[model samples]
Target: MTPMIEIDEVTKYFGTKLVLDRVSLTVNRHEVVCLIGASGSGKSTLLRCVNRLVAHDYGTIRLDGVPVDDPRFGKTGLQKRAGIVFQSYNLFPHMTVLENITLAPRRVHGVSRAEATARAQEVLARFGMDGFAQAYPEQLSGGQQQRVAIARALMTKPDVLLLDEITAALDPELVGEVLAIIRGLKDAGMTMMIVTHEMGFARDCADRVAFLSDGMILEEGPPDRIFGAPEQPRTRAFLDRIIASGRL
Candidate 1:
């Protein structure tokens, strides 16, 4: 079976400073991969490269074995192949929940308003946010807004979903609800790449876990191996500091 996403010898540089050093990985369909590391580890950069949000300076990225970084990717067709959800819920505050979810589908995909609404309603129901369809972003809580953001991304019916710290800004009490929604997506076989600090959720939801350090992948393995018995000194040290600091 073809992998959903593949990165090979990928390197990204900002000025003379290199951020990603020949990093490579593969994510299969229905699989969840978690990227864990300190800030400036290139985890976010790698995510951006997957969708051409930040074009790489070197190396190749293939989506379902089709080279995506090539200019042909856009000329041929790959723009609607993936979806992204950010740390901050980037919602249109002026639009109602349904409107926000329906905008892209209607405009970009040429999905009729009525058809988009139907899909939005189904997605919102799946996200447990159907009750808020008529509500505005400001009227909803942070967790609720993030769920709306997820639903909006799902509105595109993407093959791969990129989540960057989607739960980071939420109140502690509200984290569980968002994580629960993600768990539901995983249970339903959504292919995902998650950059998160929520260790327990990553361990529970990730098929594989990767430890990124500096600009390189210091360790990677099944969750049991990465979390239970990390092979690298950097991995163990990182985990130690997080645990000792009571941040894990």
Candidate 2:
């Protein structure tokens, strides 16, 4: 598979506090790579840096072999190519589901409302959300809202998708439904880089799994290797803790 996203010796700092320390990784086209670690391990920060939501302090991030900071891909251009969905669902409470999904294309990409609405309806129906186009965020369940968020991200037809703990805020029963959507995306050949605490989902769905410690990748391999026989002591310890907590 061709490399879709690449990070080489990337570093990030938050007010002098080092968040990422020369981290490097690669995500291939039509692949799902999961970043797994405890909170504050820089998984989320790394995902943000990919789309320039949080600029890296050093090193480089390239999308499809082009530097992310290249002037050709202006801020909106980069975002349009790399759609992101966060844990909070980030929907506009004031807007209906259709409105929220169509906002970016209509406003930022110069898509007409009629065209955007038609596209939104098609995507929503694909996600089984066609019935809720007129509903507000608060009117939907957590799972439904999250599905809407994913649908909204898909509106831009991104080249790669970044998911940051997308199931972290859901109820246990609702988690599966959201994860199911990701599984569907994977089946349809959507390239995704995911930051997640859901170890089982990562193990089952990801083509590769990367374990991050502090701000660096400690061990990375197929799920069978990482979950079944991690070579690094730190990775073993982290998995042990997750197992003890009954989270893995």
Candidate 3:
């Protein structure tokens, strides 16, 4: 079967610095792949390239077998196919939760207001944000706003979801709520590529775990192998740090 996401020797740079260096990986349908790496390891950059948030400098990224940079693919089409959520809740502060969730569906997807609203309500209820329809971004907790962002992404019925350090901005007590929602997504067989620093969460939730260092995937395997006995010395050192920090 064709993979849902494929990256082939992809490389990216920001001015003089290389962010992703000849990286390649695949995520099959209904698979949850977690990227576990220290800061500046190109985790978020890879996801952005997948979703076409930033164009890759070399190599190719394909989604559902189509090149992401192909002219026919189009930005809106790519955005619709791969919904993304970030660490900072990117909700429009002036909009209510319902409006925020429904805006893209109604505008970009050409969904009617009533239809968009119904979809929003259903996904919000699914994510345990049922009563937050009228709340503004500032009024909700960080976790709730993040949930709203995820729900909004789901509203578009994306083929793949990209999450970039989504819990990085949340309070310790609030992290579980958002992670619980992600676990629920995994249970529902959503195809996902997540960048996260939470090792325990990565171990418990990822179908496969990849450890990246210096813009390359140093090692990737089943969670047990990658976490219990990382082969690469670099991976071992990183996990040792994670253990020292009491995260693993």
Candidate 4:
């Protein structure tokens, strides 16, 4: 079967600095792959490349069987299929939750306002934000805003979701709520690629775990092996640091 996402020998650079170097990975349908590494490890950059939010300097990224950069995808098409949610909730401060969620479907996909709103309402209810449809971003807590952002991404019914340190901005007490939403998504078989610093969450939710260091994928395997018995010394060192910081 064709993989839902395929990154092959991809490389990226920011000016003279290389952010990703010959990285390769794949995520099959209904599978969740967690990317764990320290800051500046290129995990977020790699996720962005998959959706063309950031372009790779070399190699290919494919969605299903088609190259992400193919003209057929256009910018909107690719994004419609591969939705992304960031650490910071990017909702428009002026828009209500319902409006924020339905904006893309109504504007980019050309769905009628009524239909877009109906879909947004359904997604919001699923994410436990049904009562907040009229609430502005500032009116909700950090977790609520992030849930709205995830709901917005799902409004288009994306085939694959990319999450970049989604719980990073939340208060410690609020992190579980956001992570619970992800657990529900995993139970529902949503295909996902997540860049996160939450090692325990990664171990529990990921079908596979990848360890990236200095722009390279040094090790990847089932979460048990990657978290329990990583092969690379670099991978071991990283995990040790996480354990030292009491984060693993």
| Model 2 Cα lDDT, one tens digit per residue, 153-220 | 99989999999999989999999999999999999999999999999999999999999999999989
C-alpha TM-scores of all predictions: 0.96, 0.99, 0.98, 0.98
Indicate the worst ten consecutive residues by lDDT in candidate 2.
69-78
lDDT of each: 0.89, 0.96, 0.93, 0.94
Predicted candidate 3 versus true structure: per-residue lDDT over 208-230, tens digit per residue: 99999999999899999999988
How many clashes does each candidate structure show, in the order listed?
0, 0, 0, 0
For candidate 3, give the lDDT of residue 41: 95
User: For each candidate, C-alpha RMSD in Å?
Assistant: 1.5, 0.6, 0.9, 0.8
Which is the better candidate, 2 or 3, if ranked by lDDT?
Answer: 2
Candidate 4: worst 10 consecutive residues by lDDT? 1-10
Cα lDDT tens digits for candidate 4, 1-248: 45999999999999999999999998999999999998999999999999999989999999988999999997599999999999999999999999898988988999999999899889999998999999999999999999999999998899999999999999999999999999999999899999999999999999999999999999899999998999999999999999999998
lDDT of 1 at 79: 53
Global CA lDDT computed for model 1: 0.89
Better of 3 and 4 by lDDT: 4
Whichever of 1 and 2 has more TM-score, that candidate is 2
- Where is model 3 more than 4 Å wrong at Cα? none
